[model samples]
Target: MVALMCAEAVILGTNSKDYQIYSLGDRIFCCAPSTGIERGIMLEISNQVECQYRERGIKPTMDQVRDMLARKYENVSSENVLLVGQDRHGPHIYAMKGIGIPQTLIYAAKGKGRDDIIGYLMHNWKKSLNLAQAEQLVRTCLLVGENDYVNMCVIYKEKETWAKAVPQLEPVAIMAYDTESAFDDMTSMGSNLSN
Candidate 1:
């Protein structure tokens, strides 16, 4: 799993099976080792979270979500979970280990190929990245080979809030280029993820 905050959006990506990413209100939730039980737990939590925000207009804090997960951790099969969202305080990334307290992060990756993904992000991520650049970065980092597919979610606020999840059935073709060239291409194509 990979979760990062870009200039105007939070991006989450994973190559895991069984639909590991979900939307909770305005937030994007991602978990690793997705199983039937974990999916069920996530569904329950998402409903509760959406209700809290919809009925009371109160967004649940990362800590609150973590506490909720802790209460149900014993039955879940997930080992790592990431939550990304924005609030009055701005964008936030929360990384949780099992039922542990959520750790605030600017970017996070877990499960298989985590080290490689983290290293790539550490060397490549920039604060100025737009939605296209961030999405491409995630796609590049997640490309293990010629046959891997990626599931991605982009969470951004326009007038209200929006979350888009795209599941790629075909393998993403990897390209080699410097950051400057990639940025130029993205700009020329006007490749906004929201579009």
Candidate 2:
């Protein structure tokens, strides 16, 4: 009997305090986020890819590298990896899981709060969000979430990607008030939360 393995892909980004965003050229952007054992796996994969690119002086297509890693990880039952990159043509997002064989994750895959987050993003996300806007979406997800599993996040494109440590947000001093009044209250309390 073949035992099937399942895993969830974690898409996280850092808090606003310290964020690392990179730009390679004019089009390519990249960000990688992994945790648990997959952290080491991701590092190894990234190092190998960088080494190869250095030697060849040419970057391989994201699909090619992804398929190669999937093959390498086919033996693992549960693995989570999220790699976001874009080329001149457009963006390429890869959310992968190592089941019986490593398979790419689609938008429909459900794992805990994954569905809710995906739904939130689907409604808020657009093709036209600039780099800052994109980063905001990621930050908002991590900042507003109740989940502890996500401690990091990566937001990347073909030219630049940002990775940062996402610190948990403290409970807000919520109060009943008008919208404008609430905004001012929150703004004042926001600085205290960071302290």
Candidate 3:
């Protein structure tokens, strides 16, 4: 169904307590959970933003980009996240609903267990977190939940006057470890529990 699946992006706003922690012109990176059909939507939206920026010699505002996506996507359902550059403003983060609603996220995660993840953030999120700290918090939430449903992590940061193309991170295995190796930990623990 081309349902836009899961994409995660974080935007620390002016009101954010950790805003001052990051330098003035850091780049905002948009990450797609995995390379697949679902990731296509995010790519297209980003492409559109880039095209508009190139033609206009200015980055489109979130609202403008949102409208463009809404028109292009029409009724297609899918998961999408965008952290495109905002002209003079800092980076803007948004999740585009299949129905074309560009919902802004403030330290929010989308996709499976989105509700629970949001709740978790509400309880544990701190205002003093820097960019890296915020990213770690998101990573921790996914890891602690053992959310196998999501497998993609992308980082977004805004730069000075122009938006730099943030690179995708190398894929890594998500594992639960208690100092023991994978096979050793699971098998040994299994035997003990059964006994």
Best by TM-score: 1
Cα lDDT of model 1 by residue, 43-161, tens digit? 88888988998899988865576567667675443456777766545577877765545677889987778888899999999988999999999888878544287998887744333
Q: Summarize candidate 2's per-residue lDDT along 1-195 as a digit string, tens digits.
A: 001111211233432222222222222222322244544555566676677778987675657566655665676654334444444433445555555243443222223345555666778766566555655565565544454332333334332323435667999997776989888899989988988
Give each prediction's root-mean-square deviation over alpha carbons: 19.7, 20.2, 20.1
What residue runs in model 1 are displaced by over 4 Å at the alpha carbon? 53-57, 61-63, 74-78, 145-147, 157-195
Better of 2 and 3 by lDDT: 3
Candidate 2 ranges beyond 4 A from true positions: 1-36, 98-112, 147-195
Cand. 1 Cα-lDDT: 0.74
Worst 10 residues of 2 by lDDT: 1-10
The true-versus-predicted C-alpha distance at residue 108 of model 1, in Å, is 0.7
**TM-score attained by model 2:** 0.51
lDDT values for all models = 0.74, 0.45, 0.49
True lDDT of residue 56, candidate 2: 82
Error of 2 at 72 (Å): 2.3
Please identify which of the two predictions, 1 or 2, would achieve the higher TM-score against the true structure: 1
